[model samples]
Structures are given as C-alpha cells and as structure tokens.
Target: MTPAPRGSVRQWLAARPVAAGYILAVGSALSYGTAQFVARIAVTRVAPPLVTTAFALLFGALFLLPLGIGHFRRARRAPGKAWLFIVLAGLTAASGVAFMYSAFSLVPLVVASPLGSVYPLVAIGLTHLFLQRLERVTPRLVAGAALVVAGVVLVVVGSA
Candidate 1:
C-alpha cells in the first residue's frame, strides 16, 4: 500500500483513540525519562533539589499555559467535585516530584529513578479499587505491572 498523507495519518490515529493513547503514553515516557535524567544532573551540580523542583515545575506550567488557556473556560464550568479532584491531583503530583528530586539528590540515578517509577503499580491498585466502573482490570495490565515491578527490583538491587 502507498503511504498515506501526513494529515490523513493524524486523522487515522485520532479515529482510533486506543492507538493514540499508546503513542501519547510512549511520548510522555520518553519526555519524563529525559527530564528526570537532566534534573538529576542539575540537582547534583547546579542547585539544591528544592530549587530545581521549583524551577522545573514553574517552567512546566509556563510551557503548558498557552496550550491550556483555551480549555480554561470548560474547566471553570466543570463541577466542584471535578475541581477538588483536579486540585488533589496537582498536589499529589507536586509532592511526587519533590520526593523524586530529593531521592535523586541522595542516591544514584539508577536506584532513585526505578524506585520513583513504581507509580504504575500504585496506579493499577488505585484503578482496581476506585475506577472499576471506568476501566477493566485486564490480565495483560496485571502482567505488565508485574514486569514493571520486577524491572524496578532488578535495577534497585543490581545498583546496590
């Protein structure tokens, strides 16, 4: 088959949301991993973890502000419950970042990075407990979580 046009490729991905989610998730992983590595270097050589965290979070919000501005009106119209959850998510994510940066400052990147990445296991448990109505607990998901845990263990242990 001939190659599709560039816009048609984007349309095709958008029409299949699951595939789009996978692609976006991979992109997020690559970006997050690169940021973590750079943050590790910055905290070790340039500044304290708290300073790094502040700048990183600030720049991150600034970077997204333009993209997010268009959605603010819809966000403001969302229910109070949605606002509460959104605030909680922001706080939780901020805390996670602070803790991870602190960890990177204290230990080797190999150990700290893998330990911080165990969030997927926590996500699986939380989704199983709270989001059952929205998403299913598939065998493949469980196996993937298991493999992630095993990889983290190997990384942490091997570093020691």
Candidate 2:
C-alpha cells in the first residue's frame, strides 16, 4: 500500500472545519488549567505578586528562548509589517500571561480557570463586531456568553 501524500493532511484538516477549532480550544483549556494550578502552588510559597510574576516570566521566557531568538531574528530582518504584528502579538501575549498568572495567585483554580475561559466568548464578540462582515449576531453566541458568565459567578460564589 502507498502512503498518503503530505498535502492530504492539510486538505483533511481544512475539510473538517470545526474540528481544528475544537482541538485548539481543548488544548488551550488544558494548558491554562495546568498553568493555573502551578501558579497557585508557586504563589502559595512565594506570597509576593511581583516575585511570582518575575519567576513566571523568567522561567517562561527561558523555556521559549529558542523561539524568542528566532522571533528576534525575524523581526530584525523584516521591515515594517512584521514589526507591527510582532510588537502587537508580544504585548498581547505578555499581558495575557501576566494577568492570568496574577489572577491565579488571587483566586482558586476553579474560579480563575472559568473566568479565563470566558476569553473565547470575548474573542467571538470582537470578531463579530470588528472583523467579519457576514457573521450575524446569533442567539447561540449570546446564550454561550451568558452561560460562561453564570459559570464564573457560580465558581466565584463556591470559592468564597
């Protein structure tokens, strides 16, 4: 039997539509969940927000050193467009990780995780409002956002 072509994988992934998005969402959820748990443990011992932030940032950057180096090189080579996106992406990602770890230090994982997961609903709303012209304001998105908000409320109350 002959092996399938490499392009077939790309075609298959594109054909599935929601499968890729679902996979990405699930992966992100697991990653953030684990990170939050770790952050809680770290902050419990350290107890200083700035110290926790510094350790997390230092270790995370060390872990991604290779990628950071490559990004630096790419940014140096590319003139205008690449720097624009690189700066924006770096700022967005840095703020997000810092805030997420900070939140984990302040709240329990059950509360923080659900609150962080609500970002998807925020992204959906932003996309609908600004990026996409054809996408309609659907009841499902509204219901999903409401449910996420309710879940966050429940988590906060239970934790308290």
Q: Can you tell me which runs of candidate 1 are displaced by over 4 Å?
A: 1-12
* Candidate 1 residue lDDT tens string, 1-160: 3344567777877677897798799999999999999999999999999899999999999999998899999999999999999999999999999999999999998899888999988888999999999999899999998999999999998999
What lDDT does candidate 2 reach at residue 78?
88
**Could you report the Cα RMSD, in angstroms, for every candidate shown?**
2.0, 4.4
TM-score to true structure, per model: 0.90, 0.68
The parts of candidate 2 lying over 4 Å away from their true place are: 1-18, 65-82, 134-137
Q: Look at candidate 2 and give me any clashing residue pairs.
A: none
Model 1 scores worst on lDDT over the 10 consecutive residues at 1-10
